[model samples]
Target: MSAAEAEAAAGSEYPAHYKVMLEKLNEQRQLDQFTDITLIVDGHQFRAHKAVLAACSQFFYKFFQDFTQEPLVEIEGVSNTAFSQLMDFTYTATLAVAGEDEAFDVWKAAEYLQMQEAIKALNKKIDEFSSLAARSTSKKRKIAETSNVITETLPTVEGEHVEIQVMGEGAIEVEESGAGGSRRRCKKCSGIVRRLRFSSSR
Candidate 1:
């Protein structure tokens, strides 16, 4: 048949997860829901002879970015107390005005710990704030043909003491008078026109 159909058929012939890493990734996705182990890049969790609590704190801090308010490390699975300390330490460290090096260190630790969301946010912030040119180019561009309409009021003498006013764009005619109230009509379709009132007085 067609080339596109042939390519689609060929693609469906192969089995998914053909690579070893892909199989491991799928297994990790399954085990991630059940695992209690705290994996971090650095800071003694992986260190030999360190207390389990200390290692857990290091792992949580490094992976999760901040651990100050969290009870993650001491929970039964990961221990909520250790997690709290890690979170606290991370928050305090991140807030320090003079701790750029420490922040970078912690980021590295988090990266090593495989804290995916923290790594992504930190990287995004860095990229966004690093260059003025990049930041300027990232601004959204607005489309034309969408803008405010300017209405002009024209007064006409209708009767002895009544005055008529016409307003709005050339496509629509909105006629109003002190005695007759208001009337609207579309120039192109001859349809009845509707007047919309603004909420603000100004």
Candidate 2:
């Protein structure tokens, strides 16, 4: 069999079953009991297991290596949302964000924290979003032509008028006149944020 198949098979073996135990540990970590360290972000305190962080990140390993008596570590540069996502991964080995913008933010925070695994996971999601954007552009053009209508498209990344939308189970639809709008869903948890582009006459 191929190397990928071999790896998958190995993952199905005994040691991989231990992930269930790790997941339970993660649930307890969330409760903030018996936590050895606290990460302070945006003036908010998040309790953490030092051993878990050190095992996952060399940066944390070096930071904790000095082993000073301090129990709280303050982190700056990363927003509270991104830091929380990082902790989510640190605990459950899962990476999730609301949308491309949030994913980028989390990836940058992962870089700052020197968490290679999280960086890789976010990179894969970034690539998926990029591909989706390309497909969307082509699909939009065809739809506009078939409808014989003039369509206007506007792209906004960050702006004052930004609005957030929650979508139902079917395909996502956004009105063109409404500028600076975003829709985010998580499929595994719900539905992940796919880009929402609207078509209308300006």
Candidate 3:
């Protein structure tokens, strides 16, 4: 168990203390100081504290528990970018990814490492991204549907000069030009209109 785990198991809640400790540990990692383990992923190297890794990841916890006199380990199946981001999360309890590829790699690495908390956070982000994409697609579909409805409403009439206007929010005014110059108005729209316009030459 790590020092943080011990503190948590003792039912102690020292947010400030834990924050400072993690900050210091991250600094040590940056300086390559006191890191007892070296992980190689896809030929990229990472130096980190084993206890911290064990505390954050079930895979790492078991890996070190069975490890004997091996300070260096080679990892497979995950990209280096993901492992780096997961390491950052382990130290600071936060992750910062600059792009989509980095985000995907981090999520993949977190799963492979069996980081439950990280996976929950990543899932939330995935939900948010999915919602955003859905909304955009819906808006585009609405616009296309509106255009198609207007085109369908306008039949092929010779010398047709129909002037259409939107009435309030949900109504429309249709004016037909001819000898009578007839006009039609409605309070509620049953169909969308506006995408079709009669050719001036016609």
In candidate 2, stretches whose alpha carbon ends up further than 4 angstroms from where it belongs are: 1-12, 142-202
In model 1, the runs with Cα more than 4 Å from the true position are 10-33, 36-106, 111-121, 132-202
How many residue pairs clash (N, CA or C atoms closer than 3 angstroms) in each of the candidate models, in the order given? Answer: 18, 8, 0
Task: Put down candidate 1 lDDT per residue, 1-202, tens digits, no spaces.
Answer: 9999998877763445345534553355334433333322111121111222234334434423433322212111222223332343332322221233333444443443344444444454444444433334344222343344333222221221212122233343223223665444433312222221112122
- Residue-level lDDT tens digits of model 2 in 68-117: 44565556556778988988888788877867778888887777667889
The residue ranges of model 3 lying beyond 4 angstroms of the native Cα positions read 1-12, 98-102, 146-202
* Higher-ranked by lDDT: 1 or 2: 2
lDDT of 3 at 56: 87
Using all chains and alpha carbons, the TM-scores for the candidates as numbered come to 0.21, 0.62, 0.62
Q: How accurate is candidate 1 locally (lDDT)?
A: 0.33
| TM-score of candidate 1 versus the correct structure, residues matched by position | 0.21
What is the lDDT of every predicted structure here?
0.33, 0.64, 0.64
Residue pairs of candidate 3 with colliding backbone atoms: none
